[model samples]
Target: MSEQQKTVALEAELDALRREVQRLRARNAELEADRGFPGRLVDALPSLVYVLDLEERRYVYWNRELAELAGGNIGAAAGPLRGDGLSSMFHPDDIGRIEGYRARVAASESGEQATVEYRARGRDGGFRWFLERGVALGRDPEGSGRRMLGSAHDITAHKHTEQMLERSESLLHAFLEYTPSMMVAVDVEGRLLLVNREIESYYGMSREELLGKVVYDLLPPAASASIRKANDEIAAAGQPGASEHVLVYPDGPRNYLSTKFPIRDAEGKLYAVGTVSVDISRTKQAEAERAEMQRRLIEMQQATIQELITPLLPLARGVVAMPIVGTVDPARAEQILTTLLEGIAARKARIAILDITGVKGVDAHVAQSLVGAARAAGLLGTRVVLTGIKPQIAQTLTMAGADLSGIVTKGTLESGIAYALRARRRS
Candidate 1:
């Protein structure tokens, strides 16, 4: 235990330590040589590969893909983010999301991977999307995963595609929900695929309740059968057709003009049917009203003509004039007789003038009707005078053997009226 003995022993131990250090360095060199091809392969990958220390919140290794993604060089994001470095290389909005993604990776068990989509800012000052898939690389003393190995693939194109699809679906839904006419589309199975607002309102149901429902089940048997026939015809002919059918409800029945057509896919195969209907019940009602009004108008016109043809006018007190115009058929001759008698009784006229000044021809029936009116007035103590005795009319009455014995005859209506006035004054 002397000083000299202790120095000798210390020197021997130092020598042994030096030999052990050299052996360790040689072993390290051998391990590095063995990793040559694998390291190169990892560097050659297209994916941005990295190893992260979950507990340290920093990166342990990064491949060359990081440099390529950051635009030919790492630049600000060359390695793990330094103080405030993350804000410069990654989108500010996505920075907050990284913590949540990291937490999920840290909590996952071995062999289980977690995926996150985030945006990163490149050298061009534009943001690009990346999908990171991370798995637990190691665990801590408490068995919690603290290290993560992950790869990120650029997913900007895929994200754009998904966004476009969502936009298209939204536009289609809007068109189907707001149109004015009743419209519906059904698959071959008769399941409702689309319905517009008008259809929903007409059926007294909401879109949520109507879609996927069977059209046949919602309608009456008569309506459903008619619609089925139309649909079948359209499908078989592969053409569009129009039809009219009545759909009834508690309120009433509605007449609809519907256009039903087959819907074909790109392969020209029939897969669905669409119907657009317009309610025409009001049109039908208006037509019926118009027809009824026309009938009434015609009847009124005929009554007015009858009144004009057979008129009995009072010339003065105790004197009435019957001016007959146009051809007198048997029906009209009777009307004249009835009117003359009624006029004499109603006005208490003592004289009646039968003026045929405008008559074209007097047949036996007409001559007889005139004599009958004169005799009928005589019974009421009213004298009758006949005027407008044209030469042809006198000859015809004589040839028919008609009797005008008691009836006074005048050549013109003016002479008849003047004579009656004079007779009245004398009486």
Candidate 2:
């Protein structure tokens, strides 16, 4: 073993070591390049990417997207990434939610996935909705080495749309609940779908309890048949119709006028029936009142005609006695005068008694009718006798300037009749 031999062996060994180092360095360079690609790709992505240190509950690696989102570098952000509780980017309102999600994620096993929606501050200094999805990368039994990989998406527009839909639905519900009119919507089969507060209160049931019940089930048997007929008509016609009907409620009988129509879908196929009911008890009562008034008017007209025509028949004996009752308006005055003149001419009577004992008073029109009747009787070769003048009647007749100089007078119908009979005998 010589010095030359030792030196040669050492140089060979050193060469072998150097080759191994070169191979290892090449593998290291490949691995570094592979890692750099994903990092660079993540930084260039539009959405934020993060690697979270679960044990510390902070971001371990953050991309440029997150840096820009947070309005600062990832390490400097005020949230969990900066080790300052959680990101100040999170809305104060969403802090509890983020913490809860983090706890849930922590409790899950490695590779477990979770998602959460939270509010994050945007670069524009406004809060925007964000959806974060996280997968557990690893977990430490000691609770210090847990980690997660996550990505976040800006869901501001989607959240805003959801909020708008919620508001619109809320408004529709409120409108149905608060409107004063009794409104109801039913399926084509007459199953109740929706009813307003008024209907619920009127029917003495909650809306939830009443839904899906048949309309007929809530009504009395007598009313159910009629309401079913109306609903069927509306469905068949696909048009609105209104009618009044009597309903027997738990409270008692009531009159209701209902307007009903079909509700159509987008394709114009009838889907449901909608109805608005107005309580018409008052209106029905008013109609009854009008009918009574009309009946009274007809009765009065008939009675007046009878009274005027009956007395005229006896005028043929050369004398007639007529009794007037009730206050006389122009209409009655015309009837009386026309009857007396015609009677005098037909009967060829020499004397006729116009009795007013039953009369309360005479207006100017009545006085004129009486005067005209007397003059007409004179032309017919008849003498007119005015009788039964109360103090008020005399005053009214005098004030009206009626000429009664050619007429005889009596105080009552009996007296007028007696005078007429005596005059008839004398004739």
Per-residue lDDT over 206-308 for candidate 1, one digit per residue giving the tens place of the 0 to 100 score: 9889999988888878888898888888888989999999988688998889999999999999989999888888997898899999999998997677668
Total backbone clashes of model 2? Answer: 4
Off by over 4 Å in 2: 1-47, 75-86, 143-145, 161-180, 197-208, 236-241, 250-252, 264-269, 290-350, 353-427
Deviating ranges (above 4 Å) for candidate 1: 1-91, 119-131, 137-183, 195-214, 236-243, 257-261, 266-268, 276-427
The clash tally of candidate 1 reads 0
Clashing pairs in 2: 79-86, 79-87, 80-86, 80-87
Best candidate according to lDDT:
1
Per-residue error (Å), model 2, residue 300: 6.9
Give the Cα RMSD of candidate 2. Answer: 12.7
Tens-place lDDT per residue, model 2, 333-376, is 77787788877777767888888778877788778887787777
